[model samples]
Target: MDMASALASLSRLQHPFSRQRSGWLLAGTLALGAIPALAQSTSGVDGVWSGTAQSNGQQVPLKLEIHGEGDHLQAALLNGKQRSASSSGSYTDGHLALQFDYYANSIDASLKDGTLTGTFSSRGRSIPFTAQRNTKAEPSSPNPVNIGGDWEVEVKSSKNESAWTLHVKQSGPNVEAVIQRIDGDTGSLFGEWRNGQYEVSHFTAAGPSYAVLRPQADGTLQLVTPAHGGTTQTWTARRPQQARAAGLASPDDPLQHTRLSNPSQPLAFSGKTLDGKTISNTDPDFKGKVVIVSIGGSWCPNCHDEAPLLESLYRKYHDRGLDIVELSFEEENQLANPTRLRAMIQQLGLTYQVLLTGTPDQLNEKITGVEHLDSWPTTFFIGRDGRVKAIHTGFAGPATGDAHRDLEKETDALVKKLLS
Candidate 1:
């Protein structure tokens, strides 16, 4: 892949934001009458399922929550505790197919008796999986040690080392965890204390996701996660206080990571809306308006997390002379059809204009007046003066705990300042 596509492909690897979600839980089996078209064929396969995908020899668990009417289907691959997803599909014959529309991935499964066998496929890679109807049972007893709290985690990757915040919450034997950077976090890792280690599992519609946490005698955590090429990455965790006193540095400030080529000038770019109308800072709708320019993609997980936050801001400030425009990059298929993009806007109840900027490979060539875009979901705050006021790279959504809230407050304050 070229630089732009590589950046886009790899940008939101560990990013997640949160919204109030009425989760689709695995609840036994769906009765024969649940879906009209599949009533006869999908009787025992219509409800929630416990599934695992086998990549190499590693198994990653996920919850498949299926509920729909007629031939249409709305499915959720519940990865860990929080999955920023949007889905659609159909159930025909004994075959079931689910598309993570925005994420640009899908699952094709077939049911035999109560067992479900399928392949979760994305972007040319496919992992085979097997699932079975769930039995709703409470979690087992708590772990011998509660590894619940925030800690400073240092990840040692093959190419580099980076700092991350490990947020873990445990209930009985059920444990939920996510690794956070200043930008955001990995969506969620939910599992239980199994054997001698805490096995936290995650399965995004794309890529590998699983982590094993072992509590050491020193009251810290040792995490081992699978990486590219069957290699494993190791992480050491320590309390923030301990990390701070030991003089470990944190991730860089997001606001400082990206900047404009010239702050005195407006962002120099135009994009075609989903309907093919070009819009830019020079447009009248943005004239004298405190505008927010968001750079993202429908196929991005972090971008999915950041959309609602932008929508909330736009809804609150649009009438007060604020306008938010999303310049969304996408895959070739979405760039051509944009069906999923429209579905996403409707699914999220977004009213702001989303422009189809270009394919991921065209990102750098399409945008101007920016030094560089460090990550997906980057935002530029422009004042009514038509000058760039601030540029915040990446998102610190609810996944970052206090940092997300803090960023929201800061964003509100900045918008208020720019509007004033």
Candidate 2:
């Protein structure tokens, strides 16, 4: 899909949490509906089972690591580098259920004819999933291709061009990789090397995605990623020695230009806090203070990843002229928006002020006077003089390791310079 279509998909189906208790109850009901007839047998269900979950005609690669015996069971969902552990799970009789406390979601399935079939339910949506245990071990390659190294990758499509770091490690036929982008690491891509091709896939709360890497004759890795909307984009990655350096962009980089028509003009906005108290750009807390206007929503995984760092920044500099105002573009329902924000705040222990900024388009119009909002978790740094100083388009959360560290260092330096 194009960037616009991807953004539309994000804004429409971003919120994964149910606003009402009844919705969660309904999710539980739907989860249990998979097992109508119970047969007692737990054999052949152990070990790592991998498969795909289908939702809205999109297939998400899923890996479930199930362990323990009887009612006391453990399960972990692996999507890229994102791993969610279920606090409680049970494989009793022919029924299987795993509850993820973090997402208020559950996966319920039943074993039948050497295959487990069920649905993954969260919020109000259910995705059908099936998994089969690997009966045959993958044969080790006679001459394993060593693709283990750091690489600079550039992905170009009709919509946009972006740079990233590809970190790959291989042991025998097992290959593990992480794609470090400006926003964050693409979770963990865990797969195996077979023949001359390396294929990996991950399924996260956002959706399911996969990448195929083929080693070219010239030693460059060619990557193909399929979008949920049926569009495929190709990327090329080469080792740092052979590739041009496409280092992560700093906040002050000239290439990091603002799209706003009048950036020097102090951004104007008016919204209510989660408590319904009115707030504006001209509020006393922001006067003469270096403010960071954070544009994000509770429904975004990247936003969730960015929240803790923002909270730490607030705690470190709030008294020293640093103020953060989170303008949340949330679900359409007015009541659900605040509730979601509250949950997010409580979960992250955020002390900064959060306001309801409507949908993504509404936030774009309100802040930049434009109709196009490109990415979630975009942050605008406003100097003490009240003019916009820098605009950060996306967040690279801690999962990116050193990439995230570089972002923190640059952000801290800029904030300090503005404070001075």
Candidate 3:
């Protein structure tokens, strides 16, 4: 079946929340109406707006913060524990436009009656969204619980279990946090404490998520997440005495220990490039070269974090026999695949090749040649002889701070060993 058709069929079997999250994988266009002034309010669009965005039968709360005015305006999107700034924003002719260059997403909406109505577009899909200007004063906390420090958190759900490092800072009731998962950081989540509970949220073109932390009797915090379709998951976290680095696996560690199975096998796969050219593991371009095979997808936020580092490594070591190939397991839209890939490559200034593999399920079956893959952006390091040297699963993006630096140092050392 064609990729688009396959994806459509797969969506029917997935949970409603999953479908809503994956809607951006489809191909479509956003139709925005002309902006007309409301008779009630002539105030410029500068301030904080809070409301819920309904998409794919799910409602996610969002906050839009606009600063400055006119062409000099800047904007930030907030959901739960995520915040992303616009590449550029402008308010002109009663119209609002915000461009997120990182995800190839855009928001075009019109303001009327203290309400902003528009469509959020990513890849090729468009979802309707609305926001109402918040007029209430910022809430203050008389006795705010200090959650500053590093915490080791575990999120367990029926479908998945994962670990995360939550770094929290609080000044009075103002709270700022960053969640470092195996994949990447959750960006900056800004919110305030209320009634002894800490709350924060972030929204982006991809989707929305939030967290509500309530102190437990054992000194740990319970993170409650309300999932779409009436499901709820809780993450429990405790402050560790010492802060540790982020990332699932360290680069200095032995690669064999990180693999789930089949550590000694040479990587093998054949796929078409984004340009429709067929390529294989045995291609002449990769012969005798130290290869880094990146298994990821455009729809993955963690993959977005890892792309720039890969691009840097490629540019620095390509002449020294380093070759990188991104084996992307994209959404089932074949037509949208290239567009998303190209956007990512261009945004990161990546020169390495990207091969369009099938869906995550297909790629897991074909590439791993064993059990299903466990994570997004699993990187395979292949020696000059084309045998797998090590497999590093998951990525700790820059949000991990020192952890990210340590990863770079380890990667550089490993490359030196392979080249020597």
* Over 4 Å off, model 3: 1-108, 119-129, 132-137, 155-163, 241-260, 334-337, 370-372
lDDT of each structure?
0.68, 0.63, 0.64
Superior by TM-score: candidate 1 or candidate 2: 1
The sequence of per-residue lDDT tens digits that candidate 3 reaches over residues 1-420 is 863344334323321110012211111111111112221233698666766665434454566666556887666664433345566789987799987655657889999887999988766767677877754434656888878777777654221434567878777877766666544556455567777786665466555545676778777888765655555567777765421333432122223324535656678877788778998898999899999998887777767777878888888898999999988887677435466567666656778888887887776576765343566767888899988777776676665567678888888788778876
Q: Which stretches of candidate 1 lie over 4 Å from their true place?
A: 1-42, 67-74, 79-87, 135-143, 155-161, 204-208
Cα TM-score of candidate 1: 0.82
For candidate 1, the per-residue lDDT at 265 reads 72
Instruction: After superposing candidate 2 on the true structure, give the runs of residues whose Cα lies further than 4 Å from its correct spot.
Output: 1-50, 54-61, 65-75, 79-82, 86-108, 111-115, 121-126, 132-142, 152-154, 157-159, 162-165, 180-185, 228-231, 239-259, 333-340, 369-373
Ranking by lDDT: 1, 3, 2
| Count of backbone collisions in candidate 2 | 5
Tell me the lDDT of candidate 3. Answer: 0.64
Q: All candidates' TM-scores?
A: 0.82, 0.73, 0.74
lDDT of 2 by residue, 81-106 (tens): 34455646888887898875434457
Count clashing pairs, candidate 3.
Answer: 10
